[model samples]
Target: MDETDQAIVRLLQADGRLGHREIAEIVGLSRSAAAGRINRLIESGQVIVRGVVHPAVLDRNSLAHVGLVVRGPAEPVAALIAAREDCPFVSLTSGPHAIVAELRTSSAHELDEALSGLRGLDGVQGVETLSYIEVLRDVVGPVGETDHRIDDVDAALLHVLQSDGRASYVDLAAHVRLTPAGVRRRVLRLLDAGVVRIGALVRQPGRDGQAAMGIGLRVSGDPRDLLEQLGALPQASFLARTLGRYDLILTLRAYDPAEMLHGLEQVRGLDGVTETVSWTHLRVVKETYAFEGLAP
Candidate 1:
């Protein structure tokens, strides 16, 4: 990605629903040029734009990371796991574990059902599940409670954006029976209210030697203080406090293997971090942030 590409990405990460005109103004590009770059980014499979609902919407939602030790080929196994609706992220890893899957379910029962199906898959030897009790930070936005309530019209707009964050205002207006101006206003309001976050979900290619690691940290100090420190790290994408073998979990992505190692070292060198475990991703099968299915 070039500097302009990076700028466009940052803007979208801040608010995915930004129009081409708005993006162009910030990036100092013509409207068409900005649109072209964004299209290229999306077409190249480097970025995915979508509306991600905050976890607060679903009271009983259960999100977990499952480590699988497969007996045979990991590619096919990862592909199979990626086919399921609940398994948004499935990757073959290069640690003691052969595969890692990020599963999301609306309830505990649904989570159990998904886990059972995963266990039944052939070549799967074992499954180690880590449930996230509180997600301190996610891909595009922080996970927390929502103060504003969404009406049916608001829900419709969000539902559409959940599928396509760059959907045109005219199209959305048609869907919600509002003028183009009305649709734009509503979307801006939703973003300002923190009811939803629109941003790119980047899935870097593992074959290119980009470093992707899952680090579990065991801290010895106050949880809040430790969490604050971890959250500021550049490479950390998904960080959360859990209730299992590890006190915290982090998903890190780097441009190269060296940078990845550097990030790992930085985390280990933190003051309160007592111990750490790392897993390298060999292949990322799926990366999605759409929350349409969980929308209220």
Candidate 2:
């Protein structure tokens, strides 16, 4: 969107839970005014507010990503994919599968079970999966910079932390050229302000060595509520609100598709959940959460 909106996104990308007031301080705007702008950005489809879960630490087993190559026109197949709550970050672009998504989870067993469910889908097409063995880096921040209100320090903080969410206060202080405590204060402000949230990521699904499966969910309830339920569950990760064909997009790791199906069954007639679609990942070459910025 516009510069102000981009600034808001930049702030939230660092931490989705940041409040309008803190964001206003970072972005040089009034709290109410910053909130108005953020609301507008979300309404315009340029940015969204969502809670992000760290799968690596949260789940002992985790699902990295899945590639779905359907057998028909991309639109309808994409629509089916979109409706499922488990398939949160989907992209229907110029690719072999017509639809690609980064499924986040930590269970090897759950991952396998989800694959079976995907094979059962009516489309009757091919599926490919890629699992991330090593996460070189991960960042949660806006990708591009169209927002001009942010200062150099703020921008640098966004850029650096997007690659490493757990950067220490000492490192941040050094990079930002502030005292360690100063950096810590700023970081605390960022978190309290909702500019960013930091937590340990569960690299796998279960401590018992069970596999995790990635399931995509499309729900009828407020996407946020559905995400809250899934995120609160010990198996889900990588929740997002998207546009194009779905109201919300999310990824979850379960002991197996049955458990996921069971989860869906539990959530199914609820006012918030409508449908859940799952796909097991075959392989993952590259997966990064580093801010790639906005899509032009």
Pick by lDDT: which candidate is best? 1
Measured with C-alpha atoms, the lDDT of residue 25 in candidate 1 is 96
RMSD of each: 2.7, 17.3
What would the per-residue lDDT of candidate 1 be over residues 144-166, giving only the tens digit for each residue? 76777777888888888877888
Give candidate 2 regions above 4 Å deviation.
Answer: 43-46, 56-60, 83-86, 136-296
Please report how far candidate 1 places residue 90 from its true position, in Å: 1.6
lDDT for 229 (candidate 2): 65
Give the candidate number with the greatest TM-score.
1
Off by over 4 Å in 1: 19-32, 58-60, 207-210, 256-258, 291-296
Scored by CA lDDT, what does every candidate get?
Answer: 0.80, 0.50
